[model samples]
Target: MTATTTTAPTAASDSGLTYVDPRAPRFGQAITATVLTAGVVLAEPLFIYAIAAILGMALLSGWRLDLYGFSWRTVMIPLVGPPERREPAAPHRFAKLMGAGFTVLASALLLAGVPLAAYLLAGMVAVLAGVAATTGLCIGCRMYQQVSFFRRLGVV
Candidate 1:
C-alpha cells in the first residue's frame, strides 16, 4: 500500500479526464468557506447566495475546471505559481458532494426558518473548507480516505 496521499490522477471516471492541481480544490474550498460564512452571518438573501455558491461548486466539481487547460485557482491565487502536484479528481469530486450535501441541508434549514441548524451546518462547511484552504488538510479528503480504508477492510 502506498503511504503517500497525493498521487497523480488517472482515468478513474469514464470522462477520460485526470490530473488536477491539488491547490485548485483547496482554493475552491476557501471560496466555499467565504460564501457559507457570509450566509451564516448575513441571513436572508445571502443564504440564497450560499445556495448559488454550492450549486456552482457542484458544477465545477462535475466539470473540473482544472482538467481543462486553465485553472482560475492557478491564475488567481498568489504565491501558488505553477502546478506543483497533481491528485486524482475523484476525491475532490467526493468532497464537493459532501460540501453540496452540507450546504443543501443548511439552505433547507434556512428556508425553513431554522436559522440555528442552518448556521451550524454552514459553519461546519466553513470550518472544514477553511482548514483545507489554510492548512492543506482537507476534511472531506480525510473522510474519503477513511471510507476507502473501511471498504478495503470490508467493514462498510
Candidate 2:
C-alpha cells in the first residue's frame, strides 16, 4: 500500500516564504561594520577572516543558525519589542552573499601581501554596511531586488 501526506495551508506555508524581523539585518550590519572597521584600523587579517566566517555561516545555514539573527531574536527583541514590520528573507540572504564575497576577496588580498588594497577593500565594505545599519539603505538588498526583477523579466 502507498500512503500520501497532506498538510494544512497557512499564509507562510502556502506562499512558501518566510518573513524576518526587519531589524535583524540592521543589527547584523552594525556588527559587520564595527568588526570590519576594527580589522582595517588594526591591520588585522584575523578580524577580517572572523567576519568572513560569520558571513559564510549565514549563507550556509541562513537564519536558523545565523548568529546575528539568533542574537537579535533572543536578545534584542526583549529590549526593543517585536519589529514593526517583517521582510522576506531572500533579499537579506542575497545581501549576506555579497558581504561574504567581499570579505573573502579582502582576505585573499591580505594573504597575498597586498595590505593596502586589502584594508581599503575591507574599509569600503565597512562604510557600506555602516550606511545600511544607520540609514536602512541596503545597497546589497537593492541589488538583489534588481537582479530578481531582471530575472522575472527574462533579462538575466
Candidate 3:
C-alpha cells in the first residue's frame, strides 16, 4: 500500500479523514504481552503496577490523545515514517477497556490471594496480546463488534 507523511502524529483513514495508527495498538499489545508474561512467570504479584500503567496509557489514548502522542508509537514514527494506515478508534478504545477491566480483576485476584485464578486471568490477557502481536487477531475488537451486533439486534 502507498503511504504519505503528515505533520500530525497519527493519520487519516481510508478516505483520508481522522483516525489512529493501525500499528499503535499492535505495538502496545506486544508490550502488554511481555508485561503480562513477566507477571505470570515471576510470581511477584506485580499485576497492579504493570496493568495500571497499561490501563493508564489506554485511557490516555482513548480519552486524552494529546497525552497519548507521548507513547512509544509516536516516538518511533520518525524512524518508521508517519502512520498513513489508519482504522476506527472506537474498537481500539473498546479493546483497551476490556483489557483494562481484565487486568484490574486480575490484580484484585492477586490481592485476594487466589493465585491460580489470577494467573489464569493474566494468561488470558497474554494470549490476547500474543494473538494481536503475532497473528493480528484482536479478540477485544472482535468482541466489541460482536457486542455491537447484538446491541443492534436488540439482544444485548
Candidate 4:
C-alpha cells in the first residue's frame, strides 16, 4: 500500500501568470487618476493646468495625485481593488517609476514659476497614459528598457 502526496500551489503559481506584465496596473491607475485629476482641475482655482499635470502623473504612477496618503490600501481602494480583473496586466515597475518621476517634475515646475510648462507636460503625460490605457501599450516602460540597455554599456 502506498500513500499519495498532495501539494498546494502558491498564489503566484495559482494565478498561472507572470507577476509583472508592465501594462495592467498602469492602465488601471491611469484611468483612476484621470477621473480624480479632472475633478481637481475643475475645482481648484489657481494653477489649474499645473495641478492637473501633476495629478496626471499621479494617475500614471499609481499614486495619489492628491497630497494626502501613500499606501496601497489607500490607493488601491478606489483605483484597482474593485472589479478585480478589469485590467489583467501586472503592474510594471518601470511604469510606476516613470509616473513618479513625471509627477515630481510637474510638481516642481508648479512650484518654480513654470505653470505653463508643467501644465503642458502633465497634459502630454496624461494623454499618452490615457492612450496607453485604452490601447494596452506602455511608452514609459519601453523607454525605460531602452535607456537601461544603453546605460549598462556606459552610453547613458
Candidate 5:
C-alpha cells in the first residue's frame, strides 16, 4: 500500500495520519496469498524467491517501492477507480514487514532442504493473507495494533 505523504493530495486524511487506500492492502494481500500458495502448491522455489524479493524491497525501502502496491496504483485503480476511504498506513506497513519476515524464513527453510516445514510456514502465511484479502481482517495488522496499545500502556 502506498503511504499518503504531504505531497499526495488525494491521500490526505482529516486525522493527519499517514493513510492508504482502503483497498490497496487487501489487493496486496490477495496477490501475496496467491503467490505464496502457488509457491507451495507448485513446489517452485522461483515463486517463493520472487515474492521474497518483492517483500524484501518493501521491507527495506517502503510500500511505495512494493510491486504489489505499484500494480494496485497502475493496474487495479485504472480498472476499478479510487477507493472510497483511506486507512492508517502504519498497521499495513507492519503487516507487510511481518509477511516479509515469514517469507524470508520460509525461503531459508526451503534452501536448507526442509521443504515440508517451508511449505507449512508459507501455507500458514497464505491462509492469513487470504483471510485478510477476502474479509479485510488482517491478523498481522490487528497484532500490530495490539502491540502498539500494549506499548502505550507500558505493558509490552
Candidate 6:
C-alpha cells in the first residue's frame, strides 16, 4: 500500500478572501475618510482617538477587521497581506485626486497667512466631498472628464 498524505486548507490560503469587486461602493472607506476630513477641518483630536479605539477593539477580539478594505492587520498588527483590490470607480478617483490637491493648496495658503483663500478652498473641497458622499454624484469626476475631452480636441 502507498502512503497517503492529507492537507487541510485554512482561511489563510483561501482565494475567495483575496477578491473584492471594484464596482462595489466602499462604504467603510468613504465613511472613514469623511469622518477624518471632518475632524481635520474641525481640528478635533477625537478623530485620532476613535481610530485608536477601533484598532484596540479589533486587537482584543482576534477577529478580522477591515475599514474600506484596509485591514486592521495592516493598520496595527504588522501582518503582510495582499494589496487592496477594488474596481476603479472613476468618480472616486477624481474626487480623491482633486480633494487631495485642494487640501494641499489650502494648507499652503494657510501657511502663507492667506486666510480667505485657504478657507475658501477648504470649504469648496469639504462641500464637494460632502455632496459626493451624500449623493453619489461627483462633480470633480465630471470636471476632470470635461477637461480631458477639451484637451483632446485642443480646446484648452
Q: Rate the local accuracy (lDDT) of all candidates.
A: 0.65, 0.79, 0.72, 0.49, 0.82, 0.47
Candidate 2 residue 72 C-alpha distance from true site, Å = 0.8
- Write the residue-wise lDDT of candidate 1 on 45-109 in tens digits: 47544555555555565554332123343244344454555677667767777877877777777
Q: Tens-digit lDDT track for model 3 on 49-97?
A: 5775657665756455323344644476767776666787667767878
Give per-residue lDDT, candidate 5, residue 149. 96
Arrange candidates by TM-score, descending. Answer: 5, 2, 3, 1, 4, 6
TM-score of 4: 0.51
Q: By descending lDDT, how would the candidates be arranged?
A: 5, 2, 3, 1, 4, 6
Residue pairs of candidate 2 with colliding backbone atoms: none
Which runs of model 1 end up more than 4 angstroms from their true locations? 1-17, 48-61, 64-81
For each candidate, C-alpha RMSD in Å?
6.4, 6.4, 4.3, 9.7, 2.6, 12.1
The CA lDDT at 110 in model 5 is 91
List, in order, the clash count of every candidate structure: 0, 0, 0, 0, 0, 1
List model 2 lDDT by residue over 1-156, tens digit each.
Answer: 011113211112226666666777889999999999999998889999999888887777644467787677567767887656567767877888899889988999888999898898889889999999999999999999999999999999
Candidate 4 lDDT, tens digit per residue, 10-87? 112225543322233554456535743563466432433443454455556454343322333244434543332322
Q: Show where candidate 4 strays beyond 4 Å.
A: 1-18, 21-23, 32-91, 151-156
The lDDT leader among the candidates is 5
User: Which portions of model 3 miss their true places by more than 4 Å?
Assistant: 1-6, 11-18, 60-62, 65-69
What are the TM-scores, per candidate, against the unseen true structure?
0.72, 0.87, 0.81, 0.51, 0.89, 0.48
Compared with the true structure, model 2 gives a TM-score of: 0.87
Residue-level lDDT of model 6, residues 26-129, one tens digit each, is 34335545654664678544553353344334333432342332432233223433224433344444545565566566666666877577666656665665
Off by over 4 Å in 6: 1-88, 151-156
* Top-scoring candidate (TM-score): 5
Question: Could you give me the TM-score of model 6 versus the true structure?
Answer: 0.48
Residue pairs of candidate 4 with colliding backbone atoms: none
Worst 10 residues of 3 by lDDT: 1-10
